[model samples]
Target: MFPNQIGDFKHIINTELLKSGIYIVKIQNNTKTYSDKLIVIK
Candidate 1:
């Protein structure tokens, strides 16, 4: 369950999460589908 055309949304999340010391687990894109997972370690 993901969204299409996630370029802008993905950019925003990447910027915010990177500053917060989060790691991007994986990104899945199937045709017009897109999904991503993030992890935060303290």
Candidate 2:
């Protein structure tokens, strides 16, 4: 993640329930699907 940046949409994500590891983020838009790796350090 970038410094001073909250999120792509400026929304806060609840990372308190996430463990320290790599995560998969999937975004689906109709017939399209976007995926990205989410790394959480906690």
Candidate 3:
């Protein structure tokens, strides 16, 4: 898995190497934490 540390929370993912499945995204800050799930379709 790759982690991003950019100030702006924007990313470009190369789906070419990813298979269709369920993925989890977790984001955290000093005040709050967020989590989400993503479904990818090929």
Candidate 4:
């Protein structure tokens, strides 16, 4: 696992560890859900 700094409340994905590609990101909580596509270029 990589290191992350704590903020209000969120996911801090370290892009430096990801290669050039397209990925899907999704997150859901008690009353909400979120989704998005992430593009990483190196």
Candidate 5:
């Protein structure tokens, strides 16, 4: 994950992303929060 000071950021989820399953992604910044569910198929 890359850190951002201007309320902006970027990330790449390619590492260890070969398995097929359900995954959860979460991000937080100050009083803001984010979450998502991802489904992967082989």
Candidate 6:
């Protein structure tokens, strides 16, 4: 249900729902490191 590219993953993160105001996240990659969070306010 998600793309394999980092950019696409970022897009999903920005658009996906988190109505409870908290999310448990994980990222799997060896070549890059992501150390930030994307918050969507609706």
lDDT of each: 0.53, 0.43, 0.47, 0.45, 0.42, 0.47
Question: What lDDT does candidate 3 reach at residue 38?
Answer: 57
Report how far residue 28 has shifted in candidate 6, in Å. Answer: 0.7
What is the C-alpha RMSD, rounded to one decimal, of candidate 4? 5.2
lDDT at 20 for candidate 1? 78
Residue lDDT tens for model 1, 1-42: 334347544422455666778856444445544666767768
lDDT of 4 by residue, 1-42 (tens): 533433322344545446444333344445665545464554
Which residue runs does candidate 4 get wrong by more than 4 Å?
A: 1-20
CA RMSD of each candidate after superposition = 8.2, 6.1, 6.0, 5.2, 5.9, 5.7
Q: Cα RMSD for candidate 6? A: 5.7
The candidate that wins on TM-score is: 1
- Compare the candidates by lDDT and give the number of the best one: 1
lDDT of 4 at 19: 45
Q: What TM-score, computed on C-alpha atoms, does each candidate reach?
A: 0.33, 0.27, 0.32, 0.29, 0.26, 0.27
Model 3 is weakest, by summed lDDT over 10 consecutive residues, at: 8-17
- Minimum summed lDDT over a 10-residue window in model 4 is located at 2-11
lDDT of 1: 0.53
lDDT tens digits, residue span 3-23, model 5: 333355222233355343433
Candidate 3 lDDT (Cα, 0 to 1): 0.47
The alpha-carbon deviation from the true structure for residue 15 of candidate 5, after best TM-score superposition, in angstroms, is 11
Give each model's clash number. 0, 0, 0, 0, 0, 0
Tens-place lDDT digits, model 2, residues 1-42: 523333442222335434445344444444655555465555
Which ranges of candidate 2 are over 4 A from the true structure? Answer: 1-17, 39-42
Task: Let me know the TM-score candidate 4 reaches against the reference structure.
Answer: 0.29
* lDDT tens per residue, model 6, 1-42: 545467434322433445555433445456666545555444
